[model samples]
Every structure is written in C-alpha cells, then in structure tokens.
Target: MAFEGIWNVVMPMGRSRELVRFSKTDLLSSLQIPSERHLLVAGLETKNDYFEGIPWIVIQHNLDVIRNITISTGPRTESVTKAVDLYLEQIKVRGNKTLSDY
Candidate 1:
C-alpha cells in the first residue's frame, strides 16, 4: 500500500474540540474528513510494504483572525512548545487585519 495507516485529526465541535482518527482506506474511499472548523494537522505517520515514517507536521488554520503560519523542520533543537510560541509571535507582529476589517 502506497499510503496506508490511520490519520488522526483534531477538529472543533460546538464549544470544544475533538480528536478523530480515520483509516487511510476510509479517507480515500469517502474523500472526506471533517472541515467544519479550524484544523491542526501534526505528526503524520505513514506505513507501507517497505517502511514506516513520520515526515512532517502540517498546520492548517481556518480562521480569518490570522492569515499566515510557518514552521521549521529538520534537526530539532528546542522544545515543540517553544517552537510554536515563536511561530505565534509572527501573528502578533503581523496584526489581525481580517478581524479589524469587521
């Protein structure tokens, strides 16, 4: 299998959020994953006939409050929380134009 394994997704439901896990087959067959709220895709694990790996952490923010996000990979030097904190600073500097417009 080229892409076979489970995909764990964290999404919002009403007031709080929930983590939902989906099989690769199910996702591919249905071509659907929850998209009603903002998402944070981190730590993807994939397995096939040959090898198993965790290549990247993809972050997808679906709110108009912030428009941009960036991350660095390869050779971890600091704690994950610290890294995220630094990245969040970008949003503070950039300012929330989308919210202000409203």
Candidate 2:
C-alpha cells in the first residue's frame, strides 16, 4: 500500500520516563509545517522501555519511506521542531526520487 497523509507519532528520548503523544489533529493544526505533506509520528513511552536516543520515528505508511523523528526530554518544543524538519527532509529525499534511480 502507498504511504501518504498525516499519522500520529510518539517517541521517547534519553532516559526520561515520560510518554509523548501527538494527535492527528494536532499535526494538522501546526502552522509551522504543512500537514498535507507530512506524516505524523507519535507514540507513548513506557517506563520499562529505553529510547536509545532514537526512540521516536516518523516514517510514512509506505515501507519505501523511512523518516526519523527525534524526541527530546529537555526542551520539547525544540525537539519537536527538529523532528518536523527531519520528517520533511525525509519525504523530499524519499518521495521525490525516482524508483529506478535507486
């Protein structure tokens, strides 16, 4: 199946024992990034799990596209912003390329 559209993303970072939840509506509401071209990556963090620095991933529904979303425990705003950028870049690189090129 083709992967497109917004998706809920959740990721953990560092050793913080907290869960970060992002709703699909929240992603649509964000003005900083265009929701139409973004795939949301959000999830809950459990106490028994470790983020391993790359706890969160915002990948498209399509297996061909793999985007990395990094969630930070210190300043949430900064981390989220960075994740957005990373997502966008991934989309551009993966989606914009031709299948035969790979």
Candidate whose TM-score is highest: 2
Q: lDDT tens string, model 2, 14-91?
A: 588467876666654552323323232222110112221122323223213322344454554455455545544655
Q: How accurate is candidate 2 locally (lDDT)?
A: 0.37
Which candidate number maximizes lDDT?
A: 2
lDDT string, candidate 1, 1-102, tens digits: 112132444445555555545444454345332321111212211222332222231223322221232333433323233333444454353233222121
Q: For candidate 2, report its TM-score.
A: 0.28
TM-score of each: 0.23, 0.28
**lDDT of each model, Cα atoms only?**
0.30, 0.37
Error of 1 at 91 (Å): 3.7
For candidate 1, which ten residues in a row score worst on lDDT?
36-45
